[model samples]
Target: MNTYTRTHLAFSMLLSIAGLSLPLGAQAADRMAGKMDTDGDGKVSAAEHAVAAKAMFERMDADKDGYVTAAEMDASHAAMKKDGQATDSPMSSADKIKAVDRDGDGKISATEHEAGSKSMFGKMDGDMDGYVTAAEMEAGHKATMGGKK
Candidate 1:
């Protein structure tokens, strides 16, 4: 092949790979939004987000102890990774627990989780429209990750 043709091919391949990687974060956000959009509305209403958060709390409370320890959160993240779900959270499990561990209990109670989820929903709503679209969700995730991937 001519040098110019080879260079063009390499550039095209690089672009293709970059494009594929670029959507991973967006895709992860879309998947999360889809899961929380139980009503098939293509967006997560406040109620839907609450329900999803409750369900998540239940899942994370593996011992049914009404609280999620950092260990539990880590285990949940591990399970998500094992199941092929994207668990690329920027915060560690301990950091997550600390963020919402109201009263400094070193763990997350259901009430705390609910409160945190509510706060997160409010932030992710962006326009204060009482619903979170996929775009908003992606933006929120990015913001939570400090605008990192």
Candidate 2:
């Protein structure tokens, strides 16, 4: 093949790979939507939201005080590490808890967790119509990976 043809082919391949990636926030949002939609209701009512929210709250509430303080989250993180369940990279567990806590109270209440999940859901919804279509979810996932539409 000609050098020019080879270069063009390589560029095309690169573009194709790039098109398959997406942004982190968008990808996480899409994943959260799929996981949280337990009943396949297409929408997350407070009732349905409570199920996942409660689980997260329980996970973070080390003291079993019905609250998830930063301390509790830290303990949870340490346990995950002990079990080899935590990610190896430097995505600090503390940072994640801080980001999701929102109120700066050092705790992630059920309400707070639900709010965070809802915010992510809104991002994945894409069309701002309150419901996330399958296309939007896939697009968000792709965007998170920096891939093509």
Candidate 3:
């Protein structure tokens, strides 16, 4: 390749890696949490929450197929609802698609789940402090529930 082309390709590659570094770093940080605040720091980082979110997704997947199908979603909802643990708040299957299916292929990828987890981290980590404390979580919960805090 010509020098110009080589430089352009190199730059593009760098940008791609750079773009992924943040989220991947966040995921790594989450893995370090080893079950959310295993170190007892009195705060939860976005990475930690992302880890938890992934676990939750795995549970809802049920079939261990890495994707939560509509049938799986319904079963998950039914199980939770039957136990009165659903809070009537789980997203519908279509809503799940719109929220987490970034590829628009009607399937939620691992990357999409991680992205959703990162987004939830933003909401749960109120005050934008890069960490969530109990108070922040409570406040965020109230806000989400449309209850004044």
Candidate 4:
């Protein structure tokens, strides 16, 4: 299996730091939605996304200088580890885009993102239920990692 290199670290950090790289899956995207979506709606609107983005930026911009340097990111991630909130590195940007770019257009449009999520949801929803429980989440991740699709 291929692993993420150090170069991909910046991409992963940026995603976690700014919450811009919302996952293609609805569940993954909404993993933080409980804290992000102030409303009880299952979907995150543009406004809610904006608020989450601002909060992520603020968290990383600890110095409040409007600039998040590499050192700052390291510091913030270190803090996250101390708080036991840290996790493994993400797939490389190229691989991630390829996984979702079914049209092979090299660019994922809004439609493609939604479609990819739907497809993944179908594969993960083993019980054929509308919702995917935590068990299904692990199974989905494993299947995805194992190149099920």
Instruction: Give the winner by lDDT.
Output: 1
What ranking emerges by TM-score with the best candidate at the front?
A: 1, 3, 2, 4
Worst 10 residues of 4 by lDDT: 5-14
- Say which prediction, candidate 1 or candidate 4, comes out ahead on lDDT: 1
Clashes of each: 0, 16, 0, 0
| Cα RMSDs, all models | 13.6, 13.2, 13.0, 9.6
Off by over 4 Å in 4: 1-14, 18-30, 90-149
To one decimal, what is the Cα RMSD in angstroms of model 3 from the true structure?
A: 13.0
Summed over model 4, clashes come to 0
lDDT of 2 by residue, 1-149 (tens): 56544333322221111121223245444455556577776554445444655665677677777666556655655665587443232223344445555577765566666665555455556777766644665664454334533
TM, every model: 0.80, 0.49, 0.62, 0.45
Candidate 3 lDDT over 16-76, as tens digits, reads 1111111223333333243466457867776666666666667678878787665666676
Local lDDT at 108 for model 1: 78
How many clashes would you count in candidate 1? Answer: 0
Choose 3 or 4, whichever is better by TM-score. Answer: 3
For all candidates in order, the CA lDDT equals 0.64, 0.49, 0.51, 0.47
lDDT of 2 at 135: 60
Question: Which scores higher on lDDT, 1 or 3?
Answer: 1
Candidate 1, residue 101: CA error in Å?
A: 0.8
Candidate 3 has its poorest 10 consecutive residues by lDDT at 13-22
